[model samples]
Target: MGVLSTFLVSWLGKDAMAGVGLADSFNMVIMAFFAAIDLGTTVVVAFSLGKRDRRRARVATRQSLVIMTLFAVLLATLIHHFGEQIIDFVAGDATTEVKALALTYLELTVLSYPAAAITLIGSGALRGAGNTKIPLLINGSLNILNIIISGILIYGLFSWSGLGWV
Candidate 1:
């Protein structure tokens, strides 16, 4: 979605594109933490299942989900409250316009951190359970939906007004 958003934001202007791109880089850094949690969940769940301990597997999955969700919420709150400062510090000498745009992008995307983190955890658990197909389908559907929604919002369909980026 970030990559597609960068493409959609390009029509807004160079600054908007650069802003989204930079924001995505930072987002990836944050996502890395989620990914680590996801991997740990996968390992624990897989090990439990390997030992034929469904109860342990369930507990591991539940605990990881709770921890990841709480972490994501706290991270999102911090990012939402200090987005401008965070962007400024990360962006260094970038122009004011670019920094502002990046902050806007970061603020909007931060709202999804909880959901995204949960999804990752869910997918990891599913993969651990040897149900890879479901995870693939869920993730694929989300990416397709994201692309469609991004396109419609960035360049409205029919007569609806969009962000005028088109």
Candidate 2:
């Protein structure tokens, strides 16, 4: 996303790139929360698996699911509701169009957090089972999909192509 933003900014203008950067930064902050949750989940799952307690393992999985779901929903809601305000706050003294674009991107991207949470929990569980290959494949696939989606959506290569100045 950063590369795309830089290219767009260079091709179009600072306002466009700055808007993209703001949106990306906002997304990164939200993802950081998920990262912490993921790390905790991984540790807990590993501990349960190490103890050889199937029941506890299952419970750990459920607890992570519940926690991640609530967190993702709350965070998404906050981002969606205050998204414009956040854009404005970050892009102070910037162009109105840039702020608008940044808010739009943020609102649209926040929906992905729930799925991301699920993925993180699932990967954590798999890793706990000592099945590193599956988790690696899943993460790699996700990265590839992310690259394709980002290119298509953010770069306006698909339906959104006409939306940006680029």
Candidate 3:
């Protein structure tokens, strides 16, 4: 989804594409951390359930979601507060326009971290419970939706002249 978003942004111009690409680099790192945490949750839940311990499995899932969500919120807040500095540091030697655009993208995207963590963690829990189909469907649908929405946002529902497709 991040890569697809960058591709869509690329249509806007070179600077926009560069900015989104830079921001996405940082986003990927953050998401990799969440993926690691999700892997742990999946292992714990799978192990607990394998032992036929429903209670422990349930507790583990609940605690994992709560802790991860809280952590994501705190991380997002700090990133949002310091986004400019962070982008500046990461975007060294980039043009001012590119850096500014990257900062704005990062700031906006930080707000979604908590939701992203919840989705990743919840899907992982489901996978641990032996329901892999749901996670597959969820992720697939989200990617499709992201593409559609990004297109509409970038190009609008119709051409600006209102007489042809964008």
* Clashes per model (N, Cα, C within 3 A): 0, 1, 0
Tens digit of lDDT per residue, candidate 1, span 41-143? 9999999999999999999999999988999999999998989889988999999988888888888888889999999999999999999999899999999
lDDT of 3 by residue, 1-166 (tens): 6788788887778888898899989999999999998998899899999999989988988998999999999999999889989998999999999998888778877887998899899999999999999999998997788678667766777554321111
**Model 2 C-alpha lDDT per residue in residues 126-150, reported as the tens digit of each score:** 7876778998999999878876666
Sort by TM-score, best first: what order? Answer: 1, 3, 2
Q: What ranking emerges by lDDT with the best candidate at the front?
A: 1, 3, 2
Best by lDDT: 1
Which ranges in model 1 have alpha carbons more than 4 Å from their true place?
Answer: 164-166
**True-structure lDDT of candidate 3:** 0.85
- Model 2 residue 143 CA deviation in Å: 1.6
Cα lDDT computed for each candidate against the true fold = 0.88, 0.76, 0.85
**Prediction 1 global C-alpha lDDT:** 0.88
